[model samples]
Target: MECLASLRTRVHPVVVSAQIASALYDTGLQMVVKERCSDNSTATEEDRQKAISNFYMTYTMLSSLLPFVPAYFLTRYGDRGFRKVPIGIPLLGYLISRTLLLLVILLELPIEVMFGGAVVYGLCGGYSSYWAGVMALESASSQKERRSLCIMGIELAYGIAGFVGSLSSGHIFQIHAIGNKNGVVLVAFCIFLYFLCIIYTFFILVIPGTSAGNVEHRQEGNVGILWNIVEYPRSCNIVIVLLFISAILYDIAVAGGMEMLMSFIMKEPLNWGADQVGYSNAAGFVIFFTSFFGVWLFSKFVADAAMIMIGMVSFAAGIYFMSFVTATYLFYLARSLTLFALIPMPTIRSLLSKQVQPSSYGKILISLQLSFTLASLIYSPIYTKVYQSTLSWFPGFVFLLSSIITVLAIIPISMVGWRMARQEGYVSIEGD
Candidate 1:
């Protein structure tokens, strides 16, 4: 757990900064496109749009290659060399990529440079998959003293580091002037850096376990990977169902909240700037940091189901409250409370880990990402359309929808717990 905490301290801020940098980079690229097309009589609007679409399509195609990359390497290598080898690779790659992307953003590279970077960024996603495999080992380790300690450390680190990363991201964007209206150079630089992080992350996963061993858990038949995923065991199936529903709510609520708050409160009504964004994010981080203790406390005294229920109620209230806040300080309050409502994450993860084999960690993590992405991707267009038309309180409705869905999800969570307890012959409602 301590090691995880330390890693989170370092990694969280880095990832958050990367996110900010990436966003700024995209904005810059768009500005460059607009400027280039402005005076070009030979380029029709449709032509310009087509070019932009093609650029994005290329990037998406690159993304399609990422999930399989680490699996390919694992199948090929099987831990023949150094153990810590994979652990250190991604960190170096991240630094290298970040430096290059920073330079590109500062220098404003050509459109093709930015497009080419799409491939490198794609590679970063691939590199991170190596660590995803390690997480399986952590999950599968005996639930004795050492495993629990390790899990706690990891949870703490992820919370704190992620928060710091998020805070730093806003500040770095301001310092680099990457958020300017016209920021092509910044865009290219950011993407390059993102790719670099992917590479660096590749090295961070040094330890290997059963996946690195000679045992073959799954059958040697010709089943497709997708089929394996669909055939998860009963417990994993339940958790996955819950995770999918909860993650969709979580992502849409989070992304929509940030987008709306930043668009509205960060400027005129709030009269704030990048520094304020940093501070506000820092506050959110602190709240998340504090929640680590809440998890510990809950584990010590409260039932797991109780902790989850508390989280659900808190999260519902937090989401509902976010739709109504006005003052800048109050906005911070809302963010903090919402984050506090998320204290059950580690607990939930710990419980869910009991449901699957360690080798399935990559798939589980991918599923989590997929749920969030599915929500974000589907709602993005709808959210945009609503923002264009009903811009007032419409954004609140999005979160409210999440809250409603979350309430519905709690039912299944409770039901599953109830069924589990029944199977174990426990009769009380609080029984686990």
Candidate 2:
């Protein structure tokens, strides 16, 4: 605690400087409103406040949809093209669509039109990961060193991108506001700007890396949509049971904790605005990027299981501390620490790749996606209920539940290594 306090004393000034600059920009927007509209006697203060609140809610709902649909699309179609169109083109389409939607938020587009575009954006964003995942699986060697490094590099790059993306959002928004663009126009323009990045990614970043391999496409045969869950119970290796359960527990912990943090911890208790969510999220991404680099550096010394255990400990501690935080500094610290929990994800995914036969790689990835989707659906709604009902008491409940679940997961994950060793006859455990 003392060390954390000392770290905060050193770090808080930097965070404060950035946050203050952002707040000043928002303040400037408010000043624009004051200056442009003389007295504006027609619009009551309550009316203006109501519009702002509604816009914020719409944004949140749209953002949530962004990740889910895109992931599903990508999972289903990332490797294959539509009707012989180059797969890259459709992927480009998805990215462009998402860029437009994100731009909507950045440019401050009309809430109504953006609400529609957001749906498409969410779907494309989800799909991007599928392409990346397929590429990783195809390229990585089965050797532990090569696979670990490959997964670590991808995850580190992703975290760095996310961290940078967050910082960029604030600056873009500030620029738009300073130029006197309305919400709708500003957001549309922002989308245009990001779409350029997507185009570059597709043409420049993605093209060279992709190739038509001997990878077999899934049979579009008699496999029913729902039956895929139970029918392919063994689609993954026997160790999948452990991975499934662990993924569920970890995601549950994450979803529940985030609900507590955003809905209650920072906003309701601390009396902060929506923009604070963006800043805090950026800070978390920075920490997550740092932890991912740690995964890269320590890949040789760390077993995937050991890294997961460390992540769980950090997650539990972060959640517990978050539940009790009263100071603003503590909130930032808790969020930063919690991102350490995310560092183990790519490592776990790499382990999953190893457990299955090489022939079953695509199927296993699909199954993993299904498992996580089901877990998220089951967990998020329940967490939402708990949060809404208890209000201030919710964070503690969510954190405690996560801690207990992590404890339960320990034994199962331990058995995973043993199970893998029995199948492969060669133990890939760290220090072996």
Candidate 3:
């Protein structure tokens, strides 16, 4: 009975709700864009590709710019006892922004109006703040030893929600409402889900009390934490810095590859429709399960840093294979090779959390997310243009580039593993 209560307390209802809403919104918007681009029968396939890609580039760029300051502020506030500040604000943003998409479908608004929606979303701190806040709560609730798995558990909920949502979203999107209005029904459902998420997060959610383990670490005078890593540990700062570098590099590679991939599947031989796109997205979410189990299984034998390398290798190999994929089955086969890919980032966050006091979890995690967003400002547009220019010669060039970059990211984490073993003698915290 006590264990059942504990399990119920750890469950995150809002995370699951928001992710389902997100999956629905993604499919709705993608189909809308496909319709808008195809409205002109005169446009070539490549022309349609460039148009869709351009829309996302501008939308993503807008979304990235306004989040840095707001996310930091929300996270900072959450750290200082306003535990709901980060999550609530972003949920509000999601509600409003998703509403805008609904209006776009129903009222026949220009797609560019989503630029305004993105702005509204960013002002409230976007995904960076929301995810960082959620992780902070998770960190507060668990010991350092099991933090990786605990965090992965939140990701598991998120992925399962995304998978279920994506699997159904395409079918829902085909439902026409109010005089043959396409996606109105789907976008309306998304808004309803977000509304529920906002209410759940702000009203019903209980922020877990800080764990005794986290309190002990904080009392050890590591309050300086990720700001400085620690005082006693030799080369701690170096390890932390390397972790940051590797995380940012890995994120860029993954982000760039995935962004171009949506466009890739929409063109030429693949030319994926709404259902296929949903299935593809569902396939991506399956990795979250495989990766959670991968961590569960692998952590018994290898260190955290080793698990990070294994994930990177998984992704790099999979993405390299993706470079030659020309068929739907081939794409799924490439995706299968990435079974362990989602392990790296959350595991990296778990390691970083171990370095910091609980008070700084939101700050440090938000900072890492913000850093990745900053890097996206540089890479996102470049990925768009590279895909455009290479359309005829090779559309998969970006995937190959991502594979190479993923390999480069492994170097820093490898260095951290060596530094810990040879010098700092940092024991892998597996609880007392």
Q: lDDT tens string, model 1, 1-432?
A: 878645632433334444454444433334344444344688754454344434444444444354345433442232332222333343344344445444555565554564444445345443333344334345554463334335555555545655554555444554434456334344444656555555444434323332443333432223336446665557657755775565456556555444444434322345455456556655655655556566666667755656666677776777677666567767766666654465545445555565555444445654554445445445554544444344443534555655675577567567656656664574454474
Model 1 lDDT at residue 330:
70
* Tens digits of lDDT, candidate 3, 1-432: 876555445537888989999999998888888888889999999899999999999988888888889999989877776667798899899899999988888888888888899999999999889999888888877888899999999999999999999999989998888779878888899999999878776665655553421343344355444446445364666778999999999999999999999889888799988899899999999999999999999989988999999999999999999999999999999999999999999999998988866667888899899999999899999999999999999999999999999999999999988876765443544332
RMSD over all Cα atoms, model 1: 7.8
Model 1: how far residue 171 lies from native, Å: 5.1
Q: In candidate 3, which residue pairs clash? A: none
Residue runs of model 3 more than 4 Å from their true location after superposition: 1-11, 210-234, 423-432
The lDDT values for all models are 0.49, 0.50, 0.88
RMSD of each: 7.8, 10.4, 3.7
In candidate 1, stretches whose alpha carbon ends up further than 4 angstroms from where it belongs are 1-104, 109-119, 123-134, 141-152, 166-205, 208-240, 259-262, 392-395, 426-432
Pitting candidate 1 against candidate 2, the one with the higher lDDT is 2
In terms of lDDT, the best-performing candidate is 3
Please name the candidate that would achieve the greatest TM-score relative to the true structure: 3
lDDT (Cα, tens digit) per residue for candidate 2, span 1-432: 866544332212222222333233232232222223224568654343334333434543554545554454554453342111222333444445444444444555443554554456445443224433443343233465567556655555555555554554444444445445533333444334344534433433322122443123332233334334544336244567787777667767776566445445323346443345446556666755667766765666866777776777777777777767667798887776665676555657777776654434444565665456556556665665564445544445766676677666666666775665454454354436
